[model samples]
Target: MVVGSDGYPLPMARFFPNLAIALSRETFARIDAAETVTNLLSA
Candidate 1:
């Protein structure tokens, strides 16, 4: 979760839904790619 200057969670979904969605998608994509690579190398 993104933190605000006030030390609270940023209302990203409410104020910047597009950005929030994009960030989540990118994060998941990276994680999935990393996992795939790790599995391939382990095998």
Candidate 2:
């Protein structure tokens, strides 16, 4: 379970920088492959 500020645990952002980094890597990889851009165009 995650808490917020004011003496609370952050949901993910604070406690999961590595997860964020992994997600970012995947996102960038997809972007570099033009997957995201293609989806944007299809939308």
Candidate 3:
């Protein structure tokens, strides 16, 4: 389901933890090891 799916990992979050969130927005989610917005969920 990723455009550039080969650009990141997949263990960063519980894939589709909620159908509402997964399909609500444009679903701009991805896993980058550069430490980007990884902590946004906790904040």
lDDT of each: 0.90, 0.82, 0.52
Question: How much is 31 displaced in model 2, in angstroms?
Answer: 1.1
Instruction: Please give the lDDT score at residue 16 for candidate 3.
Output: 52
Best by TM-score: 1
Which segments of model 3 are wrong by more than 4 Å?
1-17, 27-43
TM-score, every prediction: 0.62, 0.48, 0.18
Candidate 1 lDDT over 1-43, as tens digits, reads 8898799897657678899889899999999999999999999
Error of 1 at 35 (Å): 0.1
Question: Candidate 2 — what's its lDDT?
Answer: 0.82
- What is candidate 3's CA lDDT for residue 28? 46
**Which candidate, 1 or 2, would have the higher lDDT against the true structure?**
1
Residue lDDT tens for model 2, 13-41: 77889999999999999878797688789
lDDT of 1 at 34: 100
